[model samples]
Target chain A: MRLASKASSPPRRRQSFTEFLGRREVMPFLLLVPVLIFFIIWNTIPTLWLLGLSFYRFSLTSGRPPIFAGFYNFDSILNDSAVWLGLSRTFLFVILAVGIETVLGLLLGLLFWGSQKLPGRRVALTLLFTPMVLTPVASGTFWRLIYDPTFGILGSIFRGLGLPSLNFLGDAHLAFGAVLLVDIWMWTPFMVLMTLAALASVPKAELEAAEIDQLSWWQRLRLVILYHGKFILMLGILLRTIDAFKTMDLIYDMTFGGPGSTTEVIAITLYRRAFEDFTMGWSSALAVILLLISIAFTATFIFVLHSRDRKQASLAEEGA
Target chain B: MTTWRRHLYHLLLWLIALVFFAPVAWIILSSFKTANQILAVPPVWIFRPTLANYVRVLSDPGMVHSFINSIVLSVTSVLIAVAVAFLAAFSFSRFKPPGTNFLMFLLLSIRMLPGSAAILPVYLMYVGFGWKDSYWALILFYAMFSIPFSVWILKGFIDGVSPRFDETGRVNGASWLSIIAKLIFPQVLPGVIAALIFNFIFVWNEFLFDYIIGGPHTTNVPTALSTGLYSGGGVDWTFVSCVTTLYILPPIVIVYVFQRYLLVGMTFGTVRGEV
Candidate 1:
């Protein structure tokens, strides 16, 4: 706080306009103004336009003044059968994808955490995370080939096993599942990285005490690991949820939201409307809906984080 | 029995690791194989590997041009993003503005804004300014996302650095920029490195904006490779793998050589744990 006051302080006698605009206090905001304006024009304006567009009958190509159709778009979207279907499918995908990622990430974190005792743990962790560092476009293409169901790796392996080949990218259910698998494969290690960091910082004495008390491995994990790692786990969920929701490159490349919109997550749908169809106004509305959903999740996550921070603070105070 | 269980656990770990990394491993291995060899049943592991695919990809005029384009555009964007984010993060850390929390929230909210939502109007703006198909178009657009990210991650780092040093610097009659350069920058150098590396990899791999904004002349590596793969035949799996391996090299090499920095870089500074 003293540093902040000192950082914000400046010498007196600034009579010129140049110096006035150049004051330390005003300068940061000045440097920030260009970006702030960019956000207002590029981000905030479109969002407000989208909110307005959601209340109207809209199509980009028509160029007609959007008739204020009074919740018609919302009504239509809500009443549409495919919308609910899409929502349920999206829910299933989010739950399943996040579920797999969390479990796998936890396992991987545990492995790495255990490997801290072993030689060459860093090398092992690096190799494990190579896939996570890959670009989604290339990663999607790599998997697309692997899921070929003809001469692809899995296809060949399945044929050797006397099982019918899985049409990973062709069937609706399979395609959704394929996307989820790709997401998990691509991202689980990220959770591992974060969780491993979180776990490493866990107070070793506490775990030792739990063990001394004859607590089993599971009990130690439940009592110590989760308690220390809660912030990181929440952070992982928050980051992964936002990312999975906005995922575009893979869906765009692998399925093109196809085999008939089965893989059409909201990101794909929003892209189609905004870019392919040129319905900027309506697409903005869809974007707003997505933003609302993300904000809701983020808000909940933040609330949890804040309360946890407060709880940790009070505990520290008590311990003191 | 306990020894057997330990062996089984090790076996399970290796098996899972293999499963997790197989596709990537396949891409690397297949890049060396001929197209026909790529599809060979039982997957010929002992076959003589060839560099013909890499030769072919590199010799392509378009591919060579895009390699340069990707490097220049990504480096420029990351540098600019880091520079601005450094200042913004400094301000955010040192001075509590009137609406500091609101502003910070606003900065993060930009990440959640869909790219498609802004692409069109930004494209229109580009056209108006006659900046289409130029490196500036991509550099500026990418910097838009990178700046917020740099601010978010770097602020977390800077905040973790205690304010006492800056206070001491000011007591010696140091200017703001001097304080930043001497005290804060050195203190948060690792954070800055992390932010730079993240931005570098992200821009290196960015596809959507590059595809839409970059026309034939200004194609980045991913755009060129993906589109070129679909040019005449069905997906040129061999060439695609080759290009991917090449595309994946820089980041891999970077993180490999600078593994410590990259690992420390990925931390959001929340793990400092009171020291």
Candidate 2:
């Protein structure tokens, strides 16, 4: 059948020299070469350089060339308290922020998904997404203002309610929580948007059949919504987790990883090592570790997505 | 659902929207308040709105310079990225070039790496080559970073366009460039616009590269706002609010105008990919 259809398509034209140069196969390569070259120069070379730097000891200001130091940088970083703290804190922040955002976003998505025809939905969506779209530095600045203990709105509200005002970015735990709040505020809309898109795409027949069969709310959710939305939800979580692990801008603007390094994620630590401390080799090792974690994440995500797709394909075949 | 329950749900949705919007609303409000009123203990709720903050921020040559830098950097980078990505995406979609999948995976993995990972080496290279603090440094870097996402989005869009369009153009003796440039490009223009908007916003909001590599000549809005507000002797609430308000306005406007494409673009076309 495929061969018959392929044979029925338009025949190829006579090839002039120019046409041969612009052949369908050749043209794509021509168009893609610039981008590929840019990628190689900007991404590939730098990445390889980073790898090489990770195996050497160097400082930007030392005026000495990098010296080969086989695994020394990695060994020191693995044993460094600050590195461990940053990694653990990053994991904690990702878990808490992404977890809350996902749950809240799912609820909001369910609510708004059912209210597509509601008046003001457009305005509400614009409002909801405003946070996500704002420049992170700007958002961090505004949030810092809002969290100001002296005259910020949150402080005023707390004090008005007969509660003592809490220093949001000054204390260790509160600072972490404050950062989590900022992340959730910025990203929950992402969760909502993704979830709604997934929910909206659920086949109407499947939904009607579930309803006609009188499935309870939980069962309907599990069998229909969850089944259909699981992939997208997982994709959302995966994207958010990876981004959260790289959180630096907001932290940099808000606290500079301080009140003592309480909120320093790996990105900030890496930044400090390279920029402030000028320890190029150690920073490169840290960067390599970060790259490995990100690769592990992408691999896991692709693996899960592939398995789920395969499962679905088989189930569809069985159904047919 | 019961009528009251539905009404309650709508109400809750509105409340959620408002809660999400309150911080931004506060920023906008603060921008209009007096310096003293901005830092008022009870948080001045109602005050006569003033244009003083706008007037002040706009009057600062540094602020104006940063805004121009942001516009130039973001617009150029986004345009370059979109053009490059469109060609690449077209090639991937139509030709299904050998190693295309692997190439795409490599690109996506590059994006997955924390941008900070590349900053150290790139920074050193830039300084060594005398490219640091130059517009090309930022423009090229931003364009490079935007390619993977742009390619993904544009590829998804191109996939939606049937191959028959190309064949039709060919049947009419149209060359490959004309088929892609004239026919395919127009069809995918909306996707291109989405990618453009997305890349523009990403570059505009970029902080790390701008902070580390940008200097007096090339400091974009985000970096300027960070240093301008925080590095000074005291936190001038009014000035900070004013600058931030200006800083966020462009993206806010873009987001509002293109909210329809927000999910697909923001998610790097993953949700659309599912469809």
**Maximum-lDDT candidate:** 2
- TM-score of candidate 1 chain A against the true chain A: 0.86
Candidate 1 on A97-121: residue-level lDDT in tens?
7778888888778876655334344
Clashing pairs in 1: none
- Shift of residue A12 alpha carbon in model 2, Å: 18
- The CAPRI category of model 1 is acceptable
lDDT of 1 by residue, B50-117 (tens): 99999999898888898899999899988988887788787777776677667767666666644554
Q: What is the C-alpha lDDT of each candidate?
A: 0.75, 0.86
Each model's fraction of native contacts: 0.29, 0.72
Which one is best on TM-score? 2
Measured against the true structure, the TM-scores of the candidates, in listed sequence, are 0.89, 0.94
RMSD of each: 5.7, 5.5
